[model samples]
Target chain A: MCELMAMSANVPTDICFSFSGLMQRGGNTGPHKDGWGITFYEGKGCRSFKDPLPSAHSPIAQLVTDYPIKSETVICHIRQANSGNVSLVNTHPFIRPMWGKNWTYAHNGQLADFQSRLATKYHLPIGETDSEHAFCWILDQLLQRFDGDEPNSEDLFHYVIGLCKQINELGVFNLLLTDGDFLLVYCTNNLHWLTRRAPFGKASLIDAEMVVNFDQETTENDIVTVVATQPLTDDETWHKMQKGEGLLFCKGQLIYQSS
Target chain B: MCELMAMSANVPTDICFSFSGLMQRGGNTGPHKDGWGITFYEGKGCRSFKDPLPSAHSPIAQLVTDYPIKSETVICHIRQANSGNVSLVNTHPFIRPMWGKNWTYAHNGQLADFQSRLATKYHLPIGETDSEHAFCWILDQLLQRFDGDEPNSEDLFHYVIGLCKQINELGVFNLLLTDGDFLLVYCTNNLHWLTRRAPFGKASLIDAEMVVNFDQETTENDIVTVVATQPLTDDETWHKMQKGEGLLFCKGQLIYQSS
Candidate 1:
């Protein structure tokens, strides 16, 4: 129903090269043309740019492609508007403050009867999207369990995985969520990921006629991991996640994986 | 110290003319050169653009001046960074969600012994700024009083005014806060406002050499009020607010005032 992209890097890095290919799919090569949004995290500060217009034609989207905003974690989404009307309020990459950190979420699939099933109390959706409702529901669960205190990372990871599996049972629920420190991805139907370290090579876009040599852009010690609903590059070996699987990454390294 | 600017309009209006002048103060005209931020409200959705760079030289700030994003309410700040580091996390115009509405805040003056005076429980500051600490303190009071329930506008306005008075006792606290429906302003020392209605005339900027003819740009039914730390335009008749005064505005009209 939509497309999602996220990046985690050991150093501050820009997603311009991958975003260039994804922007083409917003309206030029694909049908997800309702709206688009992106969030970049710089330390504890998160900045988001959302437009209620197709990314392929949005001047702000063009600015994003032109400006290289370096961030340790980034999340982006292009919407097809399955649950909510095409508006600025319904744009993806929804964000809220949790545990003194800005948590960002983006969804790529539709859920059935989400509003009726998911109950939220502490956090509420500003928009009418089912995706946002689900996100609020997840946060509600977290608040109920942790009660404003920070939980251990492993325990929190497992708790989030259990929540993801329950949401996945309703329908397709591929999700990307991050809180500037860690990125957590859950797959229901489609998701792919790849990590680039030391031995980086050239890559070509699958949606656009663009090529980038990672060797020229990254240092040898730099680690960068990218996750998306679909592979953006044709040459890179993207590892496809199985349904009902969840993964957590911190500083570009996989820290937890659920079998 | 920082420069604060805000607008409340009956209809969606762009702040390009006033922003042009205020941005000049970020570096060229004044000394607030640490960072700058602005938030524009579109229905329940708010979009913010912030840069930890000087607004006079930032390309993002240049784009903000060039692009006319229409909004019914706007809050902006150009920071001098007396209490916090010059980073994105410490930029002005902080936002958080409370009672299902996004509340935006910006402060112009500093606070003394703020960390010791402010005790927060429900919300915490992600950045180390006296302004942000004051904001969290105010919100904490609100949460304690209302407990997630919506309060009557008049009662809420008075309660907020009392809170502002308490914070002002600690130090200088010129504030602008909004929740999409209303704009509340508190003046500790310096604040000015002007309202333009029917029979609008030409206005010129004080910091920048730009002139705008509102008579040709606005409709007769449009009512727009702008508030700033200093009058942005040299020729406009701005009413200076008294110290320890608070005002509430909705739909460009003054609804409540306290001595």
Candidate 2:
């Protein structure tokens, strides 16, 4: 299994503070050390950084923690190589452009024979990874149903959740997907999220010895939502999603939920 | 105009030496300071770093230079922004995955009314940039001609050159494109290339006060081909490509040329 992290904010915000905690889990506090990747979406533009090296000691990961690249949406993953080779292509937070948007996806849990159903026309997996194959399969289905055009937001959200439900039956399928606008999350076994807004106080990392006071870093009008496989901070109140639950978040607000 | 740089090597080689010189031209030694980006292909996997900030002052660019990410092929660009706004979406070295390969592209010149011909079926430009739209147009043509599959080398190369000639007639269209396997270069007005092998010597950078001895850095079996909009090194002899010329290079070998 791997670990996933995603963020959606009303304004462009950095993940340095939360990423510092996640990096420690890559090898220091957890056993996941295969590879790591992150994607930041600024408007319609997407920027990604990936390393085959373990994030616990990767110099690039260190740079990410030190530098702050603000974005409206972000997705990150640390791999453990349960399904694919520990290579650059297999690094997660894979991105493809669809509907004139940078669509990025990252998977946390394993899938059983996921590629068996991967019959694609427009999108193809660049690497031999179950996660990438699943991403492509999802995109292909969306394209076929919508015919190269995006549907209404509600229809798109509902259709995606239906697809996730179909995949979740195959195995554990916790995922985070975004197209530089909204974040879609589906939970099979484990997932948690938290939102920060006005009257913010302090939060401390569970995996690292660090603390950040949101009062000093964010304004009263700032709204930021962070979703992860597990709670990243020890003090924050993270709400755990139920199994087979689907969610959609945009501009740091939860707008839709599966029935 | 912007600047373009690309490399094809027999081995996984780092472009720190050449990139160091190019970054200086981003804002320090030249005026093309709108934005910059680079894509490095290691095997079939690709890692890219892009910034709307000027490369000369970008901390991400500094990390890229300080950390050596070796790759078999690389495409880089420093934008002067003649056709698009100075934003992250307009940064060069755009990428799209096709035929299970990450196709990366960078352009040095602007096209006049190029988007008018863009009638894409599979690929679409997410950003408002002439270079990206042209890239999508090229891919759409490739997909249409081959019926959703890559054509044979001879046919693909000839067809691409023919399409490039058509685009070149519109305006300046010097471009570097790759599918992580081979580097394709199309010259409209100006481009230069240099290949270095066993009998290497000292080379000095033109934009920065830096010198490197290839003898100490490379093995006798290493072969590297570097392409740029202008000569990047002062002491090396670079070959200038002719107008309307299309060249294909793979594993440091020039394999095809247009008639």
Give me the TM-scores of chain B across the candidates: 0.99, 0.97
Report per-candidate DockQ: 0.71, 0.87
Q: After superposing candidate 2, which stretches have Cα over 4 Å from the reference? A: none
Clash tally for model 1? 0
* Model 2 chain B: ten consecutive residues of lowest lDDT: B113-122
Model 1 per-residue lDDT tens digits across residues B41-98: 9898888889899999888888889889999999999999999899999998999888
What is the clash count for each candidate, in the order shown?
Answer: 0, 0
Q: Which is the leading candidate under lDDT?
A: 1
TM-score of chain B of 1: 0.99
Q: Please, what is the TM-score per model? A: 0.98, 0.98
lDDT of 2 by residue, A76-126 (tens): 999999887989989988998888888999998878868775566667888
Compute the TM-score of each model's chain A versus the native chain A and list the values. Answer: 0.98, 0.98
True contacts kept of each: 0.53, 0.87
Best by DockQ: 2
